[model samples]
Target: MCADYLLELASQLEFETVSACDTRDILEQLLESLAEHSAVTDIPVDEVVLANLHLALHQLDAIARGRGRPAINIPFHVIEGYLLHGFNVKEISELFGVTRQTIHRRMNDNGLRKSDVYSALTQEELDAVIGEIQQSHPHTGYRMMKSFLQARGLLVQTTRVRDSLRRIDPIGTEVRALANRTLRRRQYSVPAPNAMWHIDGNHKLIRWRFLVHGGIDGFSRLIVYLSAATNNRAATVLEAFIGAVNKYGLPSRVRSDKGGENMEVAQFMVESRGENRDSHITGRSVHNQRIERLWRDVYIQVLDQFHILFSNLEREGMLNPDDEGHLFALHWAFLPQLRRQLAFFMDAWNLHGLRTAGSQSPYQLWASSRHHEDPDQVEADYGIDWEGPYGFDDLGHQAGQVEVPQVQLQRHLTEEDMARLPDPNVHFMDAIDIYKATLQQLMQPRSEVDEGGSDA
Candidate 1:
């Protein structure tokens, strides 16, 4: 086309006498041709295009480059979508199906870009948003926290929050860091919740010390068991677990840390802990190690901040700043006498604690099994059919009087399941030996008792 046009121009004018008017007209025609090419095809002629093209040609001159210069495959949908939406970096990136960095480069090439809009927000608005976010979720990233405003009809994007957040927050760098999931290489379980259970311990410093041991039902993601005590001992662990078992029934498997309390020999015997075991505990499971580490963030970051606040007050000779000082004093003194209190709190945690995720108390989850009552429905006599709440006595009476429907499940056991089931194994023998040792320890009575016959 170029050759044909040049030939016609040369014929129309003098062959060698080139005029400024002719050159300008030819250049304009070439520019129009290039513009038409950009519109028709996504050849990715952006800011970097000319310089990159020149570099490629120069490199090819030295050594024939294999493969054509890597032209970015800019999809047409991206460009059209950006134009329709009034292109912003994030929207543009979304249009191009690429990152903001890509959009930034594309805009630079096209010479159509704007400075970040987050900076345009007033200081008061920024403070209000940031304050609300911090109050709601201190641990949440700025990007994630922006949805609070967006929910209330503010045009806040995660990126905008992220940029503005950096200015006001000292931990702005950390906030941005958290936005990116760089450490997503951690293992993920199956998609379903009931596929795995995560258990862990956390130390909570309230009025008194709390060693929180908890279990979540894998399928329900419900708090099956929660024991908050002054101490996370084997006995407390057993009680907490027993409560969960009595409530939720035995899970397919129980997962926990290798802590002495969780991996207790006696507890394992009761559970028959192993893969494919007939015992309460199931086989092949992931443990609560992840949650345990998450607590480091909670304890060090959340609780530690409180601790610092209190410590600063003490250092300034202002003990009991507000009523919190009394609470802090109680906490300081109560840590020592916390063990006995833990036993009581363990039961309370199961029965009274509210769940942050579900907004239902642990007791509510357990009590959901109770029968429904229809007060509106009346008998022939117009007596309200108030099925008395199913308390322990009611359950006993119902069991004795009426036959509740029972499901009898039957399945042919696989070899793997059979092998996993507990029976007369070497461990069982060792358990017997341990029991004998315990008996000996108990049976060795006091000297006076040993000499005497039966007690008076």
Candidate 2:
């Protein structure tokens, strides 16, 4: 009766029951077939049913079909771990007592295979790859380095690259330090290149007091113009502003700090856009953080090194303090070199890839956003020579060459003026009293005096 029942059950389950000596053998074979079916269909068997199958197999001494229990009972995660470590299907099949086909199917289901687990690159090879990336981008952290490597068709894990960089790249340390010092203030967004402009001056070069005035586009951070002069006066600031406007059309708004040097620029902006519109002057420099942050980069890349060289030259007497000839030589010879270096720095800054901008250069970003800019906002005569006859040489006048109108002077001091002066030999308190009294006497109304004579 049991054999009949087993055969009927096997038929219902779509499997042919093998002939056996007793009910136990028949049950063991049936359980083995069920396990195989479960593995094939990837449907988990209930724990009560699985336990019953294992008991029936154990009773018949069939738990070890080839080497171990069926693959259906083993967890898929364990199999995946072995596969990731370079284990092949044949080996795994033997260990789990599963067919090669079953192992392969399970591996495919788990999204892994022998081919997916290649041998990791040697430490030396990883160092070489990291070194090359560091040479190009010294400030790149481990994650950026990984991106850079992948972009060049080299597949490497970020963890491995980071370990290799710590061992071989020393500049990575300084890069991290500078990165920490970077300001984290929020910045205003602009839709187009010429939407807004930020301008500021850097005066860190102490000995020469060279002021580097620069303007940058707020949207793209592209340096519009950079100039080095002896002072941060109104004329110097105006020249820089006009030069930038001539190159990149007028910005919708100009932003700067409320300093005397920027007064002329503020006036120009007011005159151009009308007083009802936005003013050029912002709050303090801390509020204008874009251009203020750029000053740090300029100091680190150019001004600091130049200051060191200048100090050494001065110590060696090549740059004299009192000699006017030496001063002229310093200005004519070294100043031009500094300006050339600044130009080179600006070129590199504009062309180099910025990680914040998706590895695009500032110039590239600005060029891409050009179409979105408003044509009406741009000044039509922006490129005109607005600085005509403004410089000293263009006005055809040398220093102190302008004539001054003459004014007549009093021939002598009156008695009241003489008495109001402080006595040289008096006590400090008495001198203060006499000075106050004399000031009061001078403040009183003065009697009329003839043009050719003293006061009566």
Candidate 3:
């Protein structure tokens, strides 16, 4: 929604949207916006609205305190990282868990200057670049195009991006722009980071006996866990669910589809959350927006490449779906590759800025929106000691690494395939190295492989 609309809503609600005192006011404003916009768009608030409204409501909260004293210093490297990532001082300050004045003071102290003019990129050069991007993402409008350009460190204006897109692909640009103008703001609500989680299984690779089960926090959109598994059995997904609960603790609610695999998790959520009806929600897979949304990212980032690789193997004389040997060979070769790729994707995803979350990375949002309960408060309220998660140190800072349990493929190994297949778990192996090693191993004649097994 625009400022005019927000102002109108606040006028109707009899509150000043500009000077919302605290998070409670933010929530009150958010609900007012939702109720007002529902009449027009019939949808919830979206990311852009979420981000802009938050920065607006919390503007006062982000003011520097102790005004007469020296500015609080921040590490130069962290500030540099934010600046290089194309974040302005205000957005960085909001997401950095600090006041805007502090960020400005630190920039001055560190002798750093962020330039608004991207002097090196000429309009003609940007037009050519955007034309190329349109060749792939034809449906991309100026807003998303701006994000794409920002990601490339261009830091161009939305109006400039619109000019480029309109010139490059006039029809597509007009259609998307019209849609944007007409679409109403939509948003989902969750109180805190662990307030609710949307969990689901991805069946894109199920044709090859591969399944991906994952969860995303509803509030921060943080990925709690993303796993590659050989099967979608109830026990398997339950183990993944339990593992996440062990890390982040029980969310106030768990949302998933009405599949058998989620039944156990649903029961666990119900039992864990005071046996309440609202603890676990079941519905069609399409309705689980948070986790369902992740499938697209996985496909674009990693899953599609693997799909092409396997499809090529099938097109050639190599892979036969009906053959056990070929399937087993693929399992031994590629599952590890898939797991590692997913891990990398997970990291990149968590760190990648979202236009929705006000340009904060998912991890950044999760960290900043963590539960407000102090240690003593948590003990008093829940009658249990809490120290965040296993990834946290004593000071409550998240450590760089947390031990992730190794995935144990549920596929049973016959004695023959075990003796015949070459090991691909080389130390310091990259995806290419793993693929090359496994393909070479798989190309060995079936007769030779059998003979090797017989010899063994």
Q: Is candidate 1 or candidate 3 better by TM-score?
A: 3
Off by over 4 Å in 3: 1-88, 91-98, 111-187, 242-250, 267-272, 351-364, 370-456
Worst 10 residues of 3 by lDDT: 376-385
Off by over 4 Å in 1: 1-129, 132-139, 143-164, 178-184, 204-208, 214-251, 258-288, 310-456
Better of 2 and 3 by TM-score: 3
Stretches off by above 4 angstroms in model 2 are 1-187, 317-325, 371-456
Tens-place lDDT digits, model 3, residues 1-456: 133345555564455444334444755666686668755655555433454455444443444242333334455676676565555788677765578888878888767777633435778998998886555345555655665565555667556877877777888777876876786544555567776788877666655667778888877777788899877777888888877765555677777766778888888877876553467776545456666556776676567767776777778877665555455567767788788767655655665667667767676677556634312112111211122112212234422222223334344445765554556564323443554555555566667766866887
Rank candidates, TM-score, best first.
3, 2, 1
The local distance difference test score of each candidate is: 0.42, 0.57, 0.62
Index of the highest-TM-score prediction? 3
lDDT of 2: 0.57
TM-score against native, each model:
0.32, 0.44, 0.53
TM-score of 3: 0.53
Q: lDDT (0-100) at residue 253 of candidate 3?
A: 74
Mind giving the per-residue lDDT tens digits that candidate 1 earns over 1-456?
Answer: 243354555555455476535544564566567568767764434432333234333433333344534444454344433333223456455533468777667656666535322235666786676775464346545533453343333435446666666666658557547655454333323222323344555544432233556666533335555454545566667777666544444443455534556555235534443433322332111223333433443443234444454466457654433343233333333333333223322332333223232533333333332222212221221111122122111223211111112212133334543342223223311333333332232233445333542443
